[model samples]
Target chain A: TQLLEQSPQFLSIQEGENLTVYCNSSSVFSSLQWYRQEPGEGPVLLVTVVTGGEVKKLKRLTFQFGDARKDSSLHITAAQPGDTGLYLCAGGGVNAGGTSYGKLTFGQGTILTVHP
Target chain B: NAGVTQTPKFRILKIGQSMTLQCTQDMNHNYMYWYRQDPGMGLKLIYYSVGAGITDKGEVPNGYNVSRSTTEDFPLRLELAAPSQTSVYFCASSYSASGRAYEQYFGPGTRLTVT
Candidate 1:
């Protein structure tokens, strides 16, 4: 079973539309990260949320960590064609040494296509 | 810095063949990871190394082996290729310090196909 689950496997919307992607899990995580990947390239880190119920905004995008730390949501306002890409969410537990072993569990990913 | 570098941008292997995927990082990070991603799926961790001479298995370690003889290099070896092993492989590294961890830097990736 996938440790983390993402909703809306694929999304297609016109530019200037609003959209939200969800990432859910049953297990709790010490930290969760969001990444965006373009075609033929590795995913790039977008945001990291460690505290429960924390909300972080990056310009037109807003990310929120569920109060239970078991879910996350990414909302985009007035999306643009440049926002088109695959969004991934990854989670991992904390290590005793305070440094995780780099074994992060990733979601299936959401491919978002914003048409101009 | 080169960050994380993976050699052989693409490779085609026949069944039963053996080859090693090379990974090297110039960031001097203490943690390195190998992950495989199938089409339309998320990346699954295969192996990871904490430092030189310390290696550990991940969720999907089957059919793969790794060796970390130095802090800069972590190589993944496939003893016998199989069609099920064909996928995109990525190598990433992160700098982990006391109570803080940095984001992982990934390479351009190596696409391997086994027939």
Candidate 2:
């Protein structure tokens, strides 16, 4: 089974602080996605990184896929209260036979709380 | 567009009861999925349908069943509700030219509590 492990399961910080969350895995993936979920709601897609070593930025958030495709990270600059949410990383890959489209295997998740 | 919509935003069930969570989309997406998220845990896929009349089990499909009788609807059935089944359920849909590089759009989610 492919598993993604996220560090700092819980994070609390004041506004304007910077932080980074990491997602690591032993198995390689074809692509990785980052999502942010608020309480009582489903996750909202933040970014998808396909190629290894690729970096994508959305406003103050930056996402990077590891060169090996087995890990990824999300960094926030000058975080605000709106950035407080559960951050999740999901790894995607094809099945053994390669005949079917791949599914996502997600990490446990990182809950960030930014106090203004 | 409405994106993805799930019914029964909240439900409470006793043991041995049965319930169905309804999900629908208007995007004409060929891929639809059912996932459950427990406290402090990421979402786990329970079932997915590639298209109408085709469905497959996902990681956590033990106590759940799903059917896609139409292109826009995928409903998840829980036979014999148990305490372990209590969680937030999400419905997602996606579309891709080759079905390889696609991103999923998610619904608001349904919260289920089983006693």
Candidate 3:
């Protein structure tokens, strides 16, 4: 079983502060995805990192995939109240049958609370 | 388009009771998934369907069953509800294509309380 461990199960920060969430795993993954979920709502995809050592940026959010594909991180710059939510990281890999598109194994999740 | 829709936003079930959670997607996606989120825990895959008439077990498929009879609908069934089954359920859909990645669109969510 693939397990992704996330740090800082809970985080609270004031507006304009920066924060980073980490997702580490012992197993390698073919791809990693980040999601943000709001109360009473399902998670929404924020980004997908397929290549090792890959980095992608969305506005003030930056995502990085580890060189060994065993870890990933989400960094929020100038965090705001709107960025507060449950952030999750999911890792995906192929089965022995070579079926690459499989269900993801998610991390424990990080709950971010930003106050303005 | 209503990317994904789940009916009966909330439900409460007693032990041994059975219920079906309805899910529908209008985007004609071939990949549909059912997941459950426990308190302070990340979502766990319950079941998934690659296409109509094709369903498979996921990470946590115990006590859950799913069916995909049409491209637009995939419903999950829980029989003999248990308190351990209480959680927020989400339905999601994504397009399936070789070498192409698609983001999944999720429904609001269904909060089920089992007593």
Candidate 4:
């Protein structure tokens, strides 16, 4: 089974503090996606990184995919209270037989709390 | 568009009861998925359908069933509700072509409790 292990399941920081969440696995994936979810709502997609060693930045957030395609990370800069939420990393792959398209395996997720 | 919509935002059921969770997407997505999220955990796929009339079991498919009669609807069925079945259910849809990365749109989610 392909598994993605997320570190620091819980995080609390003051506003403007920076934090980084990591997702690691032993299995290689075709793509990786990041999502942020609020309480009582479903997760919203933040970004997807496919190429190895690729980096994408969205304002205050930066995401990177490992060169081996077995890990990914999300780094937040100057986090605000509004940035507090559940951050999830999902690895995407197709079945070996190529029957199922875009199957995803998700990590436990990181709960970030940014105190104002 | 409505994206993906799930019915019965909240529900309570007793042991041995059965219910169906409805999910619909107006985007005409070709891929639909059902997932369950336990408290303080990540979402686990229960079932998925590649298109109308094509369905397959996922990681945690035990005690659950799904059907896709139309392109836009995929409903999940719980045969016997158990305490372990209590969790938040989410429906997602995606459209993929070739090798490009596709985004999965998620519904608000349905909270289910079994006593």
Candidate 5:
């Protein structure tokens, strides 16, 4: 079974502080996705990184894919209270067509709290 | 386009009871998925349908069944509800192309409690 492990299960920081969450796995994935979820709501997709060593920035957030496709990371600079939420990393399982089009396995998630 | 929608935002069931969770999408997505999220844990796939009339088991498919009779609908049926089955359920849909994975749109989610 392919498993994704996230570090620092819980994080609390003051507003404007920077933080990084890591998602690691021994298995290589075709693609990786990052999501942020608020309480009582379904997770919203933040970004998707498919190529190795790919980096994508969304406003104050930065996401990176490992060169080997076995890990990923999310970094937030100058985090605001609104940025506090559950961050999840999901590894996309490639199908027969070699695309990460089918099922996706998720990590336990990192709960981030940004206090003002 | 309404994206994805799930019925019964909240529900409570007793052991041995049965119920069906309804999911629908208006985007005409070809891939639909059902997942369950326990408290403090990541979501686990329960079942998925590639297209109408085609379904497949996911990581945690036990005690659950699904059917896709039409392109817009995918319903999950739970038989003999147990305590372990209590969790928040989410429905998602996506469209896949040749060699690229499409983004999945998710529903608000349904919270179910089996006592």
Candidate 6:
């Protein structure tokens, strides 16, 4: 079984502060995705990284995939109160049959509370 | 489009009771997934379907069942509810190609409590 360990399970920061969330795993994945979920709602996709050592940016958030495809990171620059939410990272892999089942192993999630 | 929709946003079921969580996607995505989220556990896949008439088990499938009879609907059934089964259920859909990764659209989620 594949497992994802995320660091900083709880984060509380004031507005304009920058923070980073890390997701590490021992198993390799074909792709990694970041999602942000608000209270009472399902997670919303933030970004997807498919290549090793790949980086993607969306507005104030930057995502990076490790060279081994076993780890990833999310960095928020100048965070705001609106950035408060549960951030999740999920790793996607193909089965032995070479089928991309779209099954994802998710991290425990980091709950970010950005005070204004 | 109503990317994905789930019914009964919140529900409370007694032990041994059975219920079906309804999910529908208007995007006609071929890949649909059912996952449960606990307090500390992020999201565990309960079941998934690649297309209509095809379903497979995920990491945690012991107490749940699912069916995909159409491209639009994939409902999850829980029989003999247990307190351990209380969690928030999310339904998601994606248009998957063979090797490429696609974005999955999720429903608001169903909060179920079994006592």
lDDT winner among the candidates?
6
**Candidate 1 structure quality by residue, lDDT tens digits, A22-112:** 9999988777789999888888989888789999999999999999989999999999999999999998665557656756789999999
Worst 10 residues of 2 chain A by lDDT: A94-103
Q: What residue runs in model 1 are displaced by over 4 Å at the alpha carbon?
A: A97-99, B97-102
Q: Per-residue error at B70 for model 3, in Å? A: 0.7
Error of 1 at B54 (Å): 0.4
Per-residue lDDT over B1-115 for candidate 3, one digit per residue giving the tens place of the 0 to 100 score: 8789999999999999999999999999888999999987888889999989999999889999999999999999998999999999999997633343446778999999998
Candidates ranked by DockQ, best first?
Answer: 6, 4, 1, 5, 2, 3
How displaced is residue A103 in candidate 3, in Å?
1.1
Count of clashing residue pairs in every prediction: 0, 0, 0, 0, 0, 0
* Fraction of native contacts (fnat) of each candidate: 0.54, 0.51, 0.51, 0.56, 0.40, 0.56
Candidate 4 residue-wise lDDT, A24-107, digit = tens: 999988788999999999899999988899999999999999999999999999999999999999988844655547778999
Chain A vs. true chain A, TM-score per model, equals 0.94, 0.94, 0.95, 0.95, 0.95, 0.96
Measured against the native two-chain assembly using Cα atoms, what DockQ does each of the candidate structures obtain, in the order listed?
Answer: 0.64, 0.60, 0.57, 0.66, 0.60, 0.66
Model 6 lDDT per residue over A1-116, tens place: 89999989999999999999999999998889999999999999999998899999999999999999999999999999999999999998844564766888899999999999
* Model 1 per-residue lDDT tens digits across residues B1-115: 7778998899999999999999999988988999999977899999999899999988899999999999999999998999999999999998643243346778879999999
Q: Which is better, 3 or 5, measured by TM-score?
A: 5
**On residues B1-115, what C-alpha lDDT tens digit does candidate 2 reach at each position?**
9999999999999999999999999999988999999877788999998899999999899999999999999999999999999999999998653445557889999999999
Worst 10 residues of 6 chain B by lDDT: B95-104
Compute the lDDT of residue B12 as modeled in candidate 5.
100
Q: For all candidates listed, what's the TM-score of chain B alone?
A: 0.95, 0.96, 0.95, 0.96, 0.96, 0.96
Docking class of 4: medium
Query: Between candidates 1 and 4, which one is better according to TM-score?
Result: 4
Docking level of model 5: medium
Residues B4-47, model 6: lDDT tens digits: 99999999999999999999999978899999999878999999
Q: For residues B1-115, what per-residue lDDT tens digits would candidate 5 score against the true structure?
A: 7889899999999999999999999998888999999866899999999889999999899999999999999999999999999999999998754354456778999999999
